[model samples]
Target: MTRRPATPLPPLEERRRLREAGSLTPDQLAARLGVAIGTVRAWESGRTTPRGRNREAYAKLLAALAESPTRTGAPGSAPAGGPEEPDAAVVAVGPAKTVSGGRRGRAAAKPSAFTQTPPPSSPFLPFLPFSPFSPRVPSWAPPEEEDPLGPVSDLTPVQAFDALYSFCAPSLVRQAYLLTGRRGLARESVERAFQLAWERWPEVARDPDPAGWVRAAAHEWALSPWHRFRPRHRRPEPPLSDASDRALLKVVLRLPPSYRRALLLHDGVGLGLPDTAAETEASTPATAGRLLHARRAIAARLPELSDPRVLHRRLAELASTEPLRTAGPPAARDGCERRARFWTRFALAFVAVLLGTTALSLRTPPAGHEPSVPPGETVRDVPPRVAPGPLSEKQRKLRAKLREELLHGPERLAPQPR
Candidate 1:
């Protein structure tokens, strides 16, 4: 295969050719190239041409598309540069079939564990119409039917966690960018949050507020094992349009850890005094006071944030750049189930042991239940006046007199209070 010379077609023609090839949509190409959708549109409209690095990137995109047959409509043929497709073979995915119980027989092919059915094509793409993936959603917005499961209303807790993240991840990423000022840090935290949420989906889904849980998880993740104890720089956001906002964020990143935490817990998470305090394990009043001071300090350094419009705009911008990392909670419900099974087995064994011991004890007669008492021993309910010890001579004489009197048919005694 011969490599073609770099064809510097006019911007409009180049964009048209890329679109005609059916390799990628303008938006997909733009995203892959890290350029704005509008930029692609402008190029297609002959409004502009890519220069330097962008030109190289565009060339690479075209080359990749040319090499990938499926991406570029090669009609059931392998890509130009890729290896040949393997011969067809049965791909089993379900339980293996067995013939007879008494005699061994051939096992049937089974379905694979990893196969996923792609969603059917529809005009709708989950949430919104134009930009299927955009930020700034109402906190209580529900998911759409176009999603893999059709709707979130019927989804299980684990599924809910995933659906919500797919919808909310973009905004969360943007928020990170706004709060941290470092785009990379913002991306890292949001991705970490998504990954962790996926890992503990069962528990998180069971939670009343899974998204909030992910938010908190992400916030803490930024200060991970590598950077937990490090002195963090503050990221101050100035007015959205003001270029100075970037510079101001650098200063915010320099704040002391406590001050930064207080400010971020309040502003970044939109947490109130009580919630922020609870998350930080501080008193509500203390948290409020600290937040007030932190905000004041940030304002003192970056006065632009004091403007309400600027602050709101910056927040909105941050909300748009949510970083998406590994998606979904890790599937670990099996671990929980195993633990539950262990406890259940242990309890059953313990109960059996206890019952066995009880039965053995019941089989033996209690010493106290014996009919006869040993010599010199006394039973609790026996009358004290009926002394078992050696009787005094007077008592013995009285006893003998009583017996004689009884024999004579008359005997009298004074009553005592005892």
Candidate 2:
């Protein structure tokens, strides 16, 4: 195949505008150009520019978008002027598949993790829209009918949560696994993250990227420094079955956590550098540096995996092929509810105990102002209680004489009284 000549693409901001003005989403453009959505996002975010054939195709697509009549604003967005990104106009457009009917125009983009909800229910993944694949990607029971990505109000909160869970959990588990080699740790991370999302569903549902919100939580938990101390995760899980896969993962694990994370988000998970950096809590440049370092390390060990696309496929494989399969959405939701109930009961019990203690103290307070004994005191003037020692023989003889002279004593006693 002949390589397309280098084409001068529009300015980065213009690229974003071109797509937005055309009512196109990242996934739409990705599908059209035969590239991963992250590649398109990277192009728009100015992290990495397209090259060779891709550059040519992108330039052509943008030129077509420029020529196409501009709509007032993209679907699901305010007309003309509205809040957009820092350097670009705000236009939210969903997957172009909404136009499958050829009438509704572009539907608003589906919520993120829509990676299989970031914590899909199993190891054998049913890759969501975000999964990297050719336009002809296959999965079981395409959700076109149920439309899990439909408007928030279309489904009850429970249904919506379950939808998010079913879609995102499996992918999230895989992602968490790649982040931390321990399979159980990965499952736990996704479970904990989803549980947290349920606790803050209000905030999460309103978020621009709810799946990403859970993804961030899961990844953070999986990569936490504290996990090393856990008895279950003290040592890494056994390596992957394939020798090549094991080698690739070994290289991945060898990198610093930050660098490994950047690599996973950017190359492994097909996220834009900006997203990767934001999720990893690093500056864009810093994220880029980490990604670069990570890629170089991988390349040094395994040359064939240098290409971002290949690396992504390998990472996905490594993550998905694990023996661990997570629980379903119902299970996740139930776990969340269970945990909430337990904590609620615990709090109520604690409050009741505290109140009871307070009431008991109030009911039986000190009756009187009972004097409290000081710590150190001794009586000074108190006499000894024992009578004087037995009188000598002289005292005994005098007592006998007094008894004999009782008559005379009466006169003496009477004189004394007078």
For model 2, residues 1-418, the per-residue Cα lDDT tens digits are 5332345565444566577677687899999999998788877754566776887788888889777644333344433464332111221211222222211221112222113323235321332222111111121123343332222234466766776776677677777777777778888998999888888888887665566788889888888998777787776567666787788778888999989888877765556777888989989999998998998899999999887656664565466466557887777788989998999999999999999999999999887898889798786533445577886676678667667866643454344453
lDDT of 1 by residue, 28-85 (tens): 8789889987677555533345666776777666666556655322456545575332
> Which residue runs does candidate 2 get wrong by more than 4 Å?
1-153, 367-418
Residue 95 in model 2: lDDT: 22
Query: What lDDT score goes with residue 232 in model 1?
Result: 55
Q: What CA RMSD would you report for each candidate?
A: 23.1, 17.1
Worst 10-residue lDDT window for candidate 2 reads 131-140
Scored against the true structure, residue 53 in model 2 reaches a CA lDDT of 81
Candidate 2 global Cα RMSD: 17.1
Alpha carbon lDDT of residue 8, candidate 2?
55
